[model samples]
Target: MNIKNTTSIFVDCHVFDSGFQGTRTYIQGLYSELIIKRDLHFFLVSSNPDNLASIFGNHSNVTYLKYKYENKYLRLLIDIPQIIKKHKIDFAHFQYTVSPFKRCRYIVTTHDILFINFPEYFSFFSKIINTFLYKQSAKWSEIRLTVSEFSKQKIHQHFGFSNYEITPNAIDNVFFEDYDKVLIKNEVAQKFSLKKYIIYVSRWEPRKNHQMVLKAFLDLELYKEYELLFLGNDTLSNPQYNEIFSQVDSEIKKKIFTLKNTDFNTMLLLLRGADASVYPSMAEGFGIPPLESVAAKIPTICSDKTAMSDFSFFEDYYFDPHNQIDFNDKLQKILKENLGTDFKIMAQKIKEKYSWKKSVEIVYRLIKQNQ
Candidate 1:
């Protein structure tokens, strides 16, 4: 249980950037907590050298190791093992499904088992790589970490690994602040030039089910008065998505604005001010947007499927992700009711269960238990 005696723990991931995704935020939060406690020495192994000092900076006990690989396959074959021995790492934590080396004790964090259940979203090469890596990582990992119990079940059902532990993701404390909702709303409305808007905060991926969201929004007879803000990565990066984007009607296109590359603070402000947050993803390990929205005291509607439904706060708020009619009904209800009493109570409940400090404590315990 004495973590201070451990020489070093290396975090292996594609990038350490804060804006990358939910996993990066989880790692950064835990890293920050560990630094303050001075209980563990941490090292981040990332692909980008530019991010090394900037993202991690000069922490007395933490170091950044630049890990370059021609490809993930090459990294598994060459670099990962070399770094483990070179740094004398006591334990290695692979943020993604794969670990490059097996010489030392390792822990692998499975964000989701989406690839195993839905392979069509990924290319043939990606599917093969993910299947191989995830299975191997699950089998080899001394301790496995997952974001939710739902994800743990999926991993066991598909990949047949059952030794993993759960560590739910958390919202930053800044998100739970008492900001003037009316003022924030006014700022967002003026900035985006809108009367009212629905919000979707997620990556523009097929699994995210954004097309369905757009279709549901269009289905709404009331949509003429309100717009839907699609905030995240630009769908233009992918050719298929780009083609879909180009063919949209001009009127719909005007209402639909995709603001790519916004900072974290701005994102929180937008979420706080939105009329309602809609996330109808087909799959997820731990959906953070709904959690964040609830923390910000905003009404949120998420798919009833996946771990998102497991939260007590979402019991009355969830809608079926697959059914357009269900989403349409929920959207109408949100617009009509607009932060109902039930919604306010749920938001309060979410703040109690999902906090950054609580989540960090879970990570701290997991590290100590395995150490």
Candidate 2:
């Protein structure tokens, strides 16, 4: 388990971005921790050179390798083997579900098996590629890591891989640190002109069940004084998202604000200042935003389904994702309650359970053990 002399570990860094969502945040946090701890020399192979540089710039131990491919199959079949051989990588880790080359020892983080469960949401070609790649990756990987017990079970049931490890995804420690709450609240309120607001941070996809949130918000007469902020980009890449955005009622749309391309600090300020954070998704691998809200001492409402229930910090705060009436009733109760005591207690508990340093330490241990 000697990791000190390991030459380098190549990472599939396609998800490295600055938007502060789940996958990008996971990779960025892990990369930052590894660089600081000197766990191993790291190299990122990705199609987006700009994102690689944006995320890893000025880190001495990290290097970026440009990977160009017209499709995932081409990357899997052609480019990856060349990069591994040329760089002499001791091990390779894929952030996504699939890995391209299998020559060296490999570890993969399976965030969730969404594609396997919801094939209709993906194209026929994409579904095929994802299914094949996941099965192959599970069969070949020296170690497998998943974010939650729910996801671990799903992976085992679907791919029949029994040797996988669990490393729960966590929030950055910086989010849990003390900040000038009054100042941040004032600044965010002024910037967004937000008087009273509830926040939902996720991509506007069908599975996210944003329409349910929207419907619940519209049903609440109490929400007339408060704005519903949807803080994530809405790329037209998902047809369902496009149709939902297009068909939203004019009155509801007026009360709704969609903010795209927000940075981590701004998002932290917003979450910290909000009255409550709501996420009623139909599915999730491991819901990170609600975890972040818990860390930030914001009252959070999330679906009682999938890995969302596995987050131990917010045990009493889940609602049915399909029951808009129930959601609205809960929202009303949250709006009326004094959340300070409960928020502080939950925030402290979350700080203990979910930390990037702990996550990286587990990952490093797993890698060293396999090495």
Candidate 3:
């Protein structure tokens, strides 16, 4: 490795606090691979530098910088540029659609343009903020990257930038760590009162299409055979919560579970032990949990919409997200299928397609090419 062309790469790690699953995984996976490269230096910027350090450990090539302010605008506009210049960064990776300053040469990862396609899901203020920042970020970025072909097309259609790259999201190989099913099942049963369960891993938000998923699961009578686990934080503020719960029978409600802030290891155990995984999201830049489930060797059923179609097993596995009948049918197929062994084979193939090692190499080459 030639040290002559080594560049200082600044990564906006603030997405760590956003609690958005896809963005968090995208950054962590890439960073984990990048940190091992001897030819580059990293400056990780986050609100919680200690926590970031704790996750990545003390890499000699990595430096962690804490952003003290809680206000996103102030931190991005003033603090971020100052930090970049202070460290004399050659390039930076903004993990999301926007970067605070345009003075430095940097790459921006625009996860998706969901706001443009699904305006009803976003507030007016959020739409405004994202619209402005997304356009500016697209214009300024040296290389724009997205998580899927669906997201890349969305960005091109909405932002009119055609030169972007598709850097698909991938699971941490940690999910593939082997576990003893009998012991893990016994432990999970005691901890979460587990039953024969199908897992749905995503935030409890409307865009995740939780209502449709719950309806489809109940309509198919799948709840009688298997518990429906909704993994993520409570969405008490979401109106759909009351509407969906109101329809649930008191007895059936016991079979529906929601676990928020679950530890990663425990979540992996849950996935491993699950009978199957269900993801009927309305839209996505790229769906991670479905792929994660497949990687965990848990049979998965996903919506046919958006980036879920990109999954290698999707042709046989996807259903119409908006149609409860189609969802119920897909759920039934997943319940009856004994394709776990085949999916495990597909999982290994899928794993090859989405290595963080490959993704970081693209980023490194992009940085080098631009220089």
- Model 1 segments more than 4 A misplaced: 1-6, 17-19, 47-58, 68-79, 189-195, 221-223, 234-248, 356-359
Give the number of colliding residue pairs in candidate 1: 0
lDDT of 3 by residue, 217-243 (tens): 677777778898888765324577568
Write one digit per residue (lDDT tens) for candidate 1, span 223-245.
68777787786432344445665
Ordered from best to worst TM-score, the candidate numbers read 3, 2, 1
TM-score of each: 0.86, 0.88, 0.93
Where is model 2 more than 4 Å wrong at Cα?
Answer: 1-5, 17-20, 37-39, 47-57, 69-74, 97-99, 118-126, 235-252
C-alpha lDDT values of all predictions: 0.74, 0.76, 0.81
Which candidate has the highest TM-score of all?
A: 3
Better of 1 and 2 by TM-score: 2
RMSD of each: 3.4, 3.2, 2.4
- Best-fitting candidate, scored by lDDT: 3
Clashing pairs in 3: none
Better of 1 and 2 by lDDT: 2
Q: C-alpha displacement of 355 in model 2, angstroms?
A: 2.8
